[model samples]
Target: MTEPSTKATPTTAERIRSAFARAGGAMLAVEGLEPAESPVHHLLDDGSFAITVPVDGAVAQLVVSAGQAGVQAVLEMTDYAPLPLREPVRSLVWVRGRLRDVPASEVSALLDLIAAEDPNPALLQVNSGNGDTDRDTRYALLRLEIDSVVVADSTGAESVGLSALLGARPDPFSAMESCWLQHMESAHREVVDRLASRLPVSLRRGRVRPLGLDRYGVQLRVEGDDGDHDVRLPFARPVDDISGLSQAIRVLMGCPFLNGLRARRL
Candidate 1:
């Protein structure tokens, strides 16, 4: 199979959703509040997120002070390449919205809903403390009502509506992208070298590294003396499973008979 020149790429909404799905943490900036880092957050279907913060921390206090009107906030998540590269950041996703506290009466129900969607252990910390514990160590739940989302990458920045983001699903390969990229960089140097040959002469001159993978294609980062450049190598077609991914990589490497490649368990 030959690689397509004009390869398919993910839609803006899909890209945003995929980035959100993969990010393990976010930097939250709220109006009248100091910027904070939150490692525990769950993206809901409504484009909002349930985040856990210190009960007596600045963010929780702001949520209480801001009241029902909510506070203007932007949660930024950076998508980093799985492999080492000159430019490690692959993309940035900004979730701009209003922040408010979940009512004490409703917090339990909301936590249940979030846990059902994403069962992260950190969620349990919200209720781990008792009145005797330090308030600063106790966690509380807050919600961010997303108004708009913008994803910035090498390609450019694109704004996605809250509704559009809610409708789009993350790439099927998202959960496995990091593992696959790391595998390519460590275990398949020759394959990567062969794939680099497919690039234009100018790009082939640089040190090519695997940057990302999705149902659409594989992204490569070329580090030359000047700077880092990103390029996408679309598969013959989109793939959904390990078998299809292997076939696609083989096609990109121009070695149909390459063997003994063990499939990774997702």
Candidate 2:
């Protein structure tokens, strides 16, 4: 039987990439404009992204003022865990770049691409062509040319190059992690307890809760009076599918039988 490693598999780049893919909202700060809440932002392949702001909003106004030179901008995005674990924010991504207005002619094509990529409802509010032509035109799109990407999490802070971030992919299990972790917390408290048992005696004193999940393994948050600590319990191997995930988790729980039987059942 393969034993699980204590080491984490998701590197800084992977974590940042995954967090960017999962983030629904971001706080954007432009050189001349006040910091604005950008709930409608989409990450592109090259680490640039489209952010929608009110056409008359400060960001749009700044873009019009800055012209082709572009304005310096920094976008901050937080990655929250699926479970309501203490310190639920698993990671924060800060992207510093140059912000420029997407030309009027390209808005249609850009909107189409963003909608195809994420299909976020916020995009619907901006796409006036979707039977909402009569609705007031409120939003304008701006693009950010990423200069650097930084990620801060329990592991630590690291600056990832745009190339490295763009090269990395979100964890294969990231999409389903929420459902799986929610189920583990709500329906399988006993399983959490079993996993907690693997923690060091010192860490076991704190309240152990599911923090994050990835193809590499599960992360646990130990919350106590001292503070919160994150521990990664890696799988025997990286898992790509639900069945593989189940087997990896079972191995982490240290059940003798690895064949379909769950550790909890044993």
Candidate 3:
């Protein structure tokens, strides 16, 4: 028997809904900046529906007016970034796989092996899709930025082009270990967890918390040796208004107390 007739191809909204369904994530189409207000339409499942189109504020309007200046992401050079690291707080998931005793502190080779395994167009897209000749150079630059970010994140800034490109100070905190932590939570998560477990101190979120400020510095409490001493990460307020974790790590590394802590941990 012949199959039943199907309707014409669904709308973009229908396709979007279907894609969300396959991914097991909810699809929320809000019209205004405030999700609750000015609801034009809502849909639980796939079908044609009207969407509220939020008016572009001055910022968005300016981006449209001037065009590409709004979107490109700079490398290690930029002072202000809307990148993931800019957030005041971040929940970092660093350990990817359950690491059985590797017998060495460095797993760089193993990570390289993983990288070698997945060398596909998807990987290229992950790195920097801007290599395509079809798109505008500006947009292409944006794609390269994203790709550069992922590579810098997966490998390391120095491993990618950022260290040379930006001549970035070895903020060590620049790695922040947060971006790589994403991989640790996925591909390297188990290994990271194993490493943490081996630490005399247990590692878990909220197990550590940033405490009160100390003399223009920030303090974090993690239960390890020294019985939860306030670990101060230094920060400097530059003439320019830029401040972040990089300052803290740079300060900690230079601290005599931290030098002792490093010696103890080693």
**Candidate with best lDDT:** 1
TM-score of each: 0.91, 0.89, 0.19
**68-154, model 3: which lDDT tens digit per residue?**
343322211112111233222211111011101111122234223334632222222211223442222111101111223211111
Candidate 1 C-alpha lDDT tens digits along 51-91: 87777679878888879998888889998887778878888
Off by over 4 Å in 2: 1-8, 127-137, 256-266
lDDT of each: 0.80, 0.78, 0.25
TM-score of 2: 0.89
Cα-based lDDT at residue 164, candidate 1: 77
Candidate 2 at residue 238, lDDT? 87
Per-residue lDDT of 1-266 in model 2, one digit per residue for the tens? 11235665987888887887788788888765678878777878756878877766788788868899988889899999877766688888988989998877787888888889778777766644345642465566889998888888766689988788778888887766677777788888877888898888888898989888888888888887888878778887788887888878888888736453232321
Cα error of candidate 2 at position 120, Å: 0.9
- Candidate number with the higher lDDT (1 or 3): 1
Q: Give me the overall lDDT of model 2.
A: 0.78
